[model samples]
Target: EGVAAFVASQGTLSYQLEHFVDSHDLLGRSVCSMGSSGSKYISSHEDSDSAQTHEGVTVVDAGTWVSEPALWVEWTHTGRLESVGETRIFVIDAERMFKALLHPGLRAVATQYAGEFHKRVVTAKPPLASYPSDIEVPHADFCGIVCCMAHPWRVQIGMHAFRKLAAAGGFGTGIAAHMKSRLKHEILTGRSVLVVSG
Candidate 1:
């Protein structure tokens, strides 16, 4: 399942997942280009016993990759989005989420995720941060509070999403939504804080 925000419905063959960083410096600029080619079905691991198409991808400056001796391994490096801040930051698996969302037959899961996300968007408090961190509170921590909040600017993305970011107009600036609607529960077992309006 690929976790991407279809900010615009324009007819473009671009799969840019929403940026998952808090960097106003990168606003309105081309970050980088990304490419995903896991179908080549080449052996990733050195040992054939556990070898599989490890979702390897190589860089293509001319929008094309030349088959060379260079071995492409799964690596995630973010220089542009990495920065220190006073606010607590939580790191989430942006790459895995996108892989799941972009999967061919996960349309139902993608739709559910989108609807659930949008529902949380307009709420007084929505659980945003997940993973290991001190400030990373869960929905169960503050369920049914008068309000909830997350730094709308901060998000985490993988190399796949980063590659597509520059072309998709420097991440998603605006998220669309309908009139106020009831938020649905997509996750049930997670323990996170939920804020409610007072």
Candidate 2:
């Protein structure tokens, strides 16, 4: 969260806007370009000159895109097989898969319902509607992972499973956990990597 502080004065903002705006007549993103074209800059901080910026936006990647997260698995198979054939299944780590899916955020919520509630807060991943007073606020991203992975095995969370996982204070069903654990340790079939470059 960021705080907003407005300091208003007669003709101050308007006067600044005159220099700040272009033909669009709006204080726009062009100002960052202006700096590249020798525009003036002011800084309140003593060492602001050394700070680096790019294209007017800073270099920060959001953990989760401000959108719902989903994982989709698809494969193309060929009939040709070796004489001594084998079936290989590749499973990605739940934590790593979730980490990559949630590359931008660790505890990012999916926003089914966010904001303060009358009795408690309602921030959870992938749209859960409630929380206990003692447990940590859940993440919507994890819920998305569980839901997507749960689809393949048809492991619906029943009442007993729900109660058991809930009793342990985890946001997962037993089937979901079993599915995720299988995914986490399932062997991979990616081509060997020789060069690692960003």
User: For model 2, what is the C-alpha lDDT against the true structure?
Assistant: 0.22
Off by over 4 Å in 2: 1-140, 150-161, 165-198
| Predictions in order: lDDT | 0.23, 0.22
RMSD of 1: 20.1
Q: For residues 7-45, write the lDDT of model 1, one tens digit per residue.
A: 111111222122222211112211122123211112221
Worst 10 residues of 2 by lDDT: 9-18
Which prediction has the highest TM-score against the true structure?
Answer: 1
Instruction: Please provide, for model 2 over 1-198, each residue's C-alpha lDDT reduced to its tens digit, 9 standing for 90 to 100.
Output: 111111111111110111211112211110011111112112221111222234332211211111111111111110111111222222233234434545332223212112111112223322344231111122333333333322222132223244454576655554577664443333121111111111
* Residue 10 of model 2, lDDT score: 12
